[model samples]
Target: MEPTPRPLSPHLGIYRWQVQMVTSILHRLTGIALVFGSLMVLAGLFALAMGETSYTAFQHFSASPLGLILLVGWTWSLVFHACNGLRHLLQAAGVGFATVVFIRNSWLVIFVSLVLTILIWAWVIFGGAL
Candidate 1:
C-alpha cells in the first residue's frame, strides 16, 4: 500500500510580520553587530598605542566611504539596542504589559531610536561643538 502524504507544518511564513517581531529580530541582530563594533574600538585603541603612524592609518580608514557606512550602521544599531533594552527592562518591571501598550511601546522604540540616530549623525556631520 502507498503511504499517505502528511501536511507540512507552518513556519515563519505563516505569521504576519509585526512591529514587535521586527524590533525583536533587530534587537538580537544589533546586539551581535555591537560586538563586532567593539572589536573596531579595540583596534582603534591599539592603533593609538602603536603611535602616530598606526593611529593615522586607522583615522584614514575610519574616514573612508566603506568605513563611514559601517560607522553609521553601528551607530544605529547601538541606539536601537539601547532603546529595545530599556523597553525590555520596563516590561520586566511590569510596565507596558497590556497588548495595546506593548504594541505602542514597540513602535516607540523604533521611532525614538531612528530619531536619536539621525540627530547624532547630524551633529557629527555638522562638526559637533562649534
Candidate 2:
C-alpha cells in the first residue's frame, strides 16, 4: 500500500489579524522593548549626572532624526505595555471574564494605549512632560 501524504499545518497568512491577537503579542514585544529602552533612560540620567559634555552628547544623539524615530517607537511600546498590563491586572481582579466582555476590553486596551501614546508624544513635542 502507498503511504498517504500528510497536510502541512496552518500558518501566519492563514490567520486574520485581530485586536486581541495583536494586543496579546504586542504586550510581550513591548515588554522586551521597554527593558532595552529603560537602559537608555538610565544612561541618559547617568550622563547628565556626570558632566555637561556627556549630557550634551546624549541630548544631541536623542534629538537626531533616527533617534527621534526610535524614541517614538519605544514610547509607543512603553505606553501599550502599560495599558495592557492594566488590562491583565483587571482580569486578575475578575473583570471582563465573559467572552464578549474580554474582547471588548481587549479592544479598549488597544485604543486607550494608542491614545495615551499620542497624548504623550504631543506633550513632548509641545515642550512638556507626559
Candidate 3:
C-alpha cells in the first residue's frame, strides 16, 4: 500500500498578532515575575527578623533607585497576575467564551491591572486610609 501524505502545518507567519496573544504571554511572564518578587519579600522579612541593624540595612537598599524600580515591577506583576488569573477562572467556568467577549476581557484585564497597580502605589506612598 502507498503511504498517504500528511497535511502541512500552518506557519506562524500566517497568524496576525492579537491582544489575546499579548494577554496570554503576559500572564505567563508575570507569573514568573511574581515568584521572584515573593523571594524579595521573603528576604525583607528575614532581614526584619534578624535585628534592627539588619532591617535598617535592608531598608536603605530598598530605598535605592534600582530597588524602587524592582518594587514597582513587582507591584505591577502582582496586579497583572491576579487580574489574568481571575479572567482565566471565569473562562474555566465558560464565561467570556465568545470571540468578542474574550478579546474585550483581555484588554480589560490589562487596563484594570494597571489601574489597580497605580492605586496601590498611590496608597502605599500617600498612606492608605491610615
Candidate 4:
C-alpha cells in the first residue's frame, strides 16, 4: 500500500509580512553587514599605515561608484543595527510588550534608521554641520 503524505510546514510564502518580523530579519542581516564593513575599515587602516601608494589606491577605490554604493549600504546597516539594538534593549527591560506598541516601535526603528543614514550622508556631501 502507498504511504500517506504528511503536511508541509509553513514557510515565507505562506505567511503575511509583519513589521516585527521584518525588523528581526533586518537586525540579523545588518549584523552581518557590519562585520564586513568592519573588515573594510581595517583594510583601510592597514593601507593607510602601509604607504602613500596603498593609501591612494584605497582612497581611489573608496571614491568609486561601486565603493560608494557599498559604503552607503554599510552606513545604513550600521544605523539600522544601532536603532534595532536599542529597541531590543528596551524590550529586554520589559517595555513595548503590547502588540500595538511593539509594531509601532518596529516601524519607528526603520524610520529612525533611514533618517539617520540620510542625515549622515547629507552632512558628508553638503559639508554642513549636523
TM-score versus the correct structure, for each prediction: 0.88, 0.81, 0.85, 0.86
**Clashing residue pairs, backbone N/CA/C < 3 A, model 2:** none
Per-residue lDDT of 1-130 in model 3, one digit per residue for the tens?
8778988867658868999988988998999998999889898999999999999988998889998899999889999999999999999999999999999999999999999999988987888469
Better of 2 and 4 by lDDT: 4
Q: Total clashing residue pairs per candidate?
A: 0, 0, 0, 0
Put down candidate 2 lDDT per residue, 13-36, tens digits, no spaces: 878977677788899999998898
Misplaced by over 4 Å in model 4 are 1-10, 128-130
Tell me the whole-model lDDT of each prediction, alpha carbons only. 0.94, 0.87, 0.91, 0.94
Which lDDT tens digits does candidate 1 get at residues 6-104?
887668788798888898889999999999999999999999999999999999999999899999999999999999999999999999989899999
lDDT of 4 at 104: 99
Where model 3 places Cα greater than 4 Å from the true spot, the runs are 1-14, 128-130
Error of 1 at 75 (Å): 0.3
- Deviation of model 1 at 62, angstroms: 0.7
Model 1 stretches with alpha carbons more than 4 Å out: 1-10
The clash tally of candidate 3 reads 0
The CA lDDT at 53 in model 3 is 95
- How many residue-pair clashes does candidate 4 contain? 0
Runs in model 2 lying further than 4 Å from the true structure: 1-17, 128-130
